[model samples]
Target: MARTSVRQLHVTVLVLMLGALSGCTSITKHIGASPSPSVTEQIGVDMHYHQVLDTLGPPTRISALPDGFAFEYESFRIDERQLGLSPNVKFLRWFKLAYGTARVARETYTLVFDSNGLVKAFGNAREDQDAGKGLAFQFIVTVTQVVDTRYLDEWPGQHAWGVSMLQPLPVALNREQSLDSGEHGIEQRGTPTSSGQRTLEWR
Candidate 1:
């Protein structure tokens, strides 16, 4: 009897460890899928163009504007589960041998830059929906729920340079434009026009 009891104890411990590993796996996948530095950390009106590139790698799209340039970045993740019910409902259904429909969640992020290569704005959005398999056509519902969406703006100040911070600005022979240039190279297609005006475009 003692031998049998020891075997049972080992089985119980193994089950517990497997359960913990499953949870950790889920958390790890979520963290690994997220974008590093995130939009919030990199969005700043006075931030330089090179700094943005170094932090976020490269944008998904780049556009030349009459004023300066625009950079767009996008990222998304999708999670799918075999149950469309709450945790409590799913647990109860498990005992009854009743199968549940599938549910899916999707999250998205978008960032945009202005003419001077400074961040113009950024947004994060999430959506949740349900999916149905064959023979479960009745359960197939076209229900799309927007979980959340947030937007932030970071336009350059009219005189951001005038407000000095005691330390002298960095100097380079090619840096002809004022701080309004956002420290971007003049080689970019959209250099400031002769009138010193900049333009912006969004889609």
Candidate 2:
């Protein structure tokens, strides 16, 4: 009986230690709503400004133009994940590893109105970035893991769970144009482009 009791105690202690050493969490934050793609379909040149507002809700910003005024809609999103390894003991806090990654996405829509309160031109732009990666020893903090830096190239493979092997393209070109202005513009780029209105997506 004594031998059986000793084994049970060892198993329980091991389980507790394992739980304390493996602590991880994920967080996602979104600010503002993505512009509706269908809104472009519903809107047209000479459309009343109030009609555009009624279809798209409210604008993020408004600017006065020499011809009239402009309405701008914007959206932003953030994705973060963290992994922590350390003993539960307070004294062992310094013996910990923190790893994490953060991603950012943004988009914008612009409408130029004539003095008659009618839509004269419209355009859209979007951007997405890996932001970066983070790694630290002996601390309770969030990590931003960016693999492009190659700083952690030599890091141990055991931490594979916290590492992202894929690297985003060095640069992407985003072009925004007014449906009527017939102008060429270049902005930042991230993922593939789709037809109609643009929206943000996480991989």
Candidate 3:
């Protein structure tokens, strides 16, 4: 099981490497080549959509436009693995000796374009932020039980659950310069979730 997991991991990473390599080539070929659409390079609202697509690509998401237009782009990373031994085997080594391996991925992006072709904004929306007026989450989840546990006669004796979380952060690639340039006005926090949850889960 361990060997097989390692092999699978190797294959998965190989596939990702190929994908990245291919992306580099394709991305470069299109660079500096997209046509300047009518009203394409404007930085204001009400821009061109086709030029945006030529510059970026099909939006990952799109808002229903009863009156106006908006679009978003999204991407994700997926990891998977298989672990060893069976729960019913009545052997601790089953789980102790085996567990699958996978990946912790971080390649996702989102771009929201208002009706006027130019990018309204771009970000990864898989975050807890009131500021995320445009971003959206793109993630995949797979749930599975250990083989031994599934076959074991003692069912649900030791209840347990798994949890996962992610947060988005961006680092400046250019010189550090604030719009204020001279002063920093920051808001201070008083507590951590400090307020706390008002309602009980059971209630």
Candidate 4:
């Protein structure tokens, strides 16, 4: 119940942001501004990747590919359900919804630049990589989903939440590498999950 309500709220907020973004299309941005800016003009036609980073800083999501890499800028709201909250809220809406205590996090937006420092070729050539897939480059992280679709890259792995917060939640590899699934709460898309582990491989 709590997770449901939280998702509904997230949808509501996203709808509102979309409505606002509609008016800001082609909106150019500079550095140091709050909420950053739209990702299109930052990396589209005639635009270079370095300029995007210069104006937007590091991308929110980054992934590697066969020949080049991809840059992804994204924003998300990690819900209580994502952190293992379904058990307590299964049949108690009033207890959790009316009086639930789940922390919320926010991000403005991200900028994605391709390996050769160019814009991606997608229908929304103007829209940021966060809204598109088939990235010839690196990562893609959104409000409810994350995908790593690349070739020739040495992918990474993760532990079962690790034994300590001392270690990263989904630990990363040295400077370059790093790293998924479950019915406990998360449902794997495009692929089935094994009993209790998420396998790693190059795409």
Off by over 4 Å in 2: 1-21, 87-90, 136-203
Poorly placed runs, candidate 3 (over 4 Å) = 1-47, 65-67, 86-106, 115-117, 124-203
What are the lDDT figures for the candidates, one per model? 0.40, 0.58, 0.31, 0.33
TM-score of 2: 0.53
Residue-by-residue lDDT tens digits, candidate 4, 1-203: 99999999999888655433221111111222223335444545435767766765765345555544554443333222211111123343112111112222333343333566665542221222222121111111122211232210112112333432443333322112222211112211123223332332221
Candidate 1: TM-score?
0.33
List the candidates' TM-scores in order.
0.33, 0.53, 0.30, 0.31
* Winning model by lDDT: 2
Question: How does model 3 score by TM-score?
Answer: 0.30
lDDT of 3 by residue, 166-202 (tens): 1111112111221111111111111122223211111
Better of 1 and 2 by TM-score: 2
lDDT of 3 at 99: 38
CA lDDT of 194 in candidate 2?
45
- List the lowest-lDDT window of 10 residues for candidate 2: 171-180
Q: Where is model 1 more than 4 Å wrong at Cα?
A: 1-39, 63-69, 83-104, 126-203
Model 1: per-residue Cα lDDT at residue 132: 36
Ranking by TM-score: 2, 1, 4, 3
**Candidate whose TM-score is highest:** 2
